[model samples]
Target: MSDSPSSWPDLATLRDRIDDIDRQLQVLINQRAECAQQVAQSKMAAEGDDTHFYRPEREAQVLRQIMERNQGPLSSEEIARLFREIMSSCLALERPIKVAYLGPEGTFTQQAALKHFGHGAISVPMTAIDEVFREVEAGAVDYGVVPVENSTEGVISHTLDSFMDSSLQICGEVVLRIHQHLMVGENSRPDKISTIYSHASSLAQCRKWLDAHYPHAERVAMPSNAEAARKVKGEWHSAAIAGDMAAELYGLTRLAEKIEDTPDNSTRFLIIGRQEVPPSGDDKTSLMVSMRNQPGALFEVLDPFHRHGVDMTRIESRPSHTGVWNYVFFIDFKGHTASSNVQQVLQDIGEKAADLKILGAYPRGVL
Candidate 1:
């Protein structure tokens, strides 16, 4: 622990120590994998074909504990992430999981999927958000990941609207910090760039930066940032606004990095699956409520939450296809459906609303 070189171990000594630690780590990792396999075997014996290998709540608890017990140079998030991959690998030994996301690869949604499920889960790219939902609903994939909202751009209406007709439940959530980068293909000149392409949300997220630096350049919105990067690959006078993954995938050079207007620009993604997630102690419940076209209806819907002391985090309204001027409210609250207070609040709101749908009660984002 001394700062002076004289008190520190030599470089060779440190290397040997690290090698010994690495060997121990390898054995421990394999032991964990063996334990995971045993867990799977136990489940198969107890429940036969009905066994559920992935428990969102249990994983959340484990990761939280990992972060809490961490005492090292690595940050809490960093330690948690390391354990995340370890858990992911162990779970794969039990049973590999397939995940679908809105993408052609190198998209933020794909990153979110990988972040939440780790590289062990097979990630399949879908062309649209709705398609991602369809895949999960049809049992083509075990789960799906889709953008729910952004810190800067607000709610993703398509994802919200998709929930209206889908039976998929929110198993978990992922919050990914978005970093926008301006990049160009090898053939493109930095000074000669006249057109820029990116997803609409990415473009909006970096609007101010673009105005300042590429004031005269044309901004074209594409299907996704990855697509934008792909498009610019053949254009000499165009550049792409995307993330590091996209840049690396398309072999583009960053003209500027972290160009988003907001420094903490982030996106929240929801994990959609068929099974309901049990309470992870810390959880969030999402609901879709429909109200009759009447005065004070919104107040009636919200009054119960206030009365029950339940913290409502977000509320977004979308037009209901059922009737004219009808709207559906998507509400997220800080508690599980199993909680007594939440049950009481739901009962009160059920009496006031035309229809109440429990979208999902899921663990809050851990990473």
Candidate 2:
């Protein structure tokens, strides 16, 4: 063959250049890991304990600082995600972490678990929320991620109830913006859809849209959105309401995107583990309190927060199962238990309330 007149370089020369680039990247990654190893060593030495391993607070602070200083075409979040994986891998080198979440896979809870632990650690998906907590408490998993509250639907009561007597501590937290999607099989026709399937919560969130479009269609509540998507195979007359990840997992097509009732809908998930996380500068503490059914009883419980200048982020009451007209209040505040102000406030509240339990203290999620 005649020599081709081309703008491209020779194959051998291009291959050599690519090899050199790969070598450089490899070297840089190793150097970063070595530095992380040094950090682990230094932390261990300072504590005078060789058994102590990874420090999540220090790792979070490092990622936050990198995100803060990051200036490039890549956004801070993108940079932080990359560093998160790197640190996760390094931590695995020290000790492999096991995480549990509610799932058969592809659930938002699984996504939150991955967000906290990255791809290096082991993730176990339980069939129920209580199973996640039980796994953590039994030491089957190093951590667990469970839904705490939804911006639109309010708190997940099962998660709260599960923690009432569990010894597991909340080590971290992650908030995921929930974007519901209309998914169908490849052979399914959007206009021909006659029925829909989804978890009760997911169906409720998309109630308005479903009512407008498929008012006459049968709405079936499945165990989970993933299960719903899996049920509708090639039926052109059926559709499922689920997250994008669930659609992808089940090989379904997205008929519509971002179909949630509210644009700002999001769900916050808690990461439960045995160890208590140190303050990440910006942190939140969750507590569940049972107050006596008396006038101004609630005020007396909250008085300590106001006196200490602690900002209350959220307060919601659930019917106490003990008897008629009884209630338990769940409170979230913008401070860590490790902080002096929060410690004093908690002490005061502890003395005033009938019962109080610190659920967890974790870094605030990045919006």
Candidate 3:
């Protein structure tokens, strides 16, 4: 009852109160940053300069705690993101982690990298997925973010293949809601648009929408959505299909939004790093299993997971380079590799499997 309209503060009074709160928030945030700096100094003194200041497990636990304790007008994710940015800034005060993503900039990978690492991270855009892997593998960057799968379009085979060749371990994961938009340059006329440029995957995702609305338009596939956005900058009768970030980056205007066939079209990305992430209590493990070409070989690989009471989250098969008809199983399951149940099943599978590589057990995406 005390929060009734009659008891509400006036506009001037409310603005003044908000201003005071903002001042307090500014001071507290900087104080936290200073403490982060002190912590960094303490870590360096104790463990030397080679110490890792950015702990994915610790960050995940902190975000989960923030979400669990949150009971407010704002959504849990909204508050978690606020805390994420704060942590990001504080982490930068300690040391900025350089992350490489599959990008030319303004792409979905860039968005995911920023979402998981926050703006404080230094993001390096690589031309290809393999390049992203190479950067992380070579220690050129602290981490790499690459798309693993999309809900609508299925798996990104290139990313998986890159992982097969690389030695980098999966450290974390992030799921991004993919929002495809039809955008155009400032001089482009809506009525004059006859051609659309986008990546092959984007075009496929929006196939139904294209059939319904712009069936006659020429659909050209490019290297990336950002590249498509780049190409359309000088053309009058051209438009690009990309995300909001690309539109803002190239000064393009959105003519249509969310044109993907599935409403909840989302992509899951993995954070690849050199060091293995310690268990965050709540975690998921990804592994690649290979078996000789034989009947029920798939069953042999998956049955242990079933019998062990382990939850297998995803499974995909990719061609094995060793032979023409051979295949490898890429699997994701819930549980840390260090846990008893997971370790038991992994050991059992290793015996029957031609080769089993523990990719890494990492905290599931918190935001």
List the candidates' TM-scores in order.
0.79, 0.74, 0.78
What local distance difference test score does each model get?
0.92, 0.83, 0.90
Off by over 4 Å in 2: 1-21, 42-52, 151-155, 180-203, 209-259, 319-325
Top candidate on lDDT is 1
RMSD vs true structure, all candidates: 5.6, 5.4, 6.0
Model 3 scores a TM of 0.78
- Candidate 2 vs 3: which has more lDDT: 3
Clashing pairs in 2: none
Cα TM-score of candidate 2 = 0.74
Cα lDDT of model 3 by residue, 1-367, tens digit: 9988778887899999999999999999999999889888888999896788888999999999989998988999999988889999999877798999988799778999999999999999998888888899888999999999876544479888877777889999999877999999989988888999999989999999989989899999999999999999888999999998899999998899998888878889999999889999899999999888899899898899989899999899999867744879999999999898898899988998888888889999998
Native-referenced Cα lDDT, model 2: 0.83
- TM-score order, best first, reads 1, 3, 2
| Superposition error at 237 for model 1 (Å) | 21
Cα shift from native, residue 153, model 2 (Å): 8.7
User: Taking the tens digit of each residue's C-alpha lDDT, what string does model 2 give over 314-356?
Assistant: 8878777666436688899998999999999989988877788
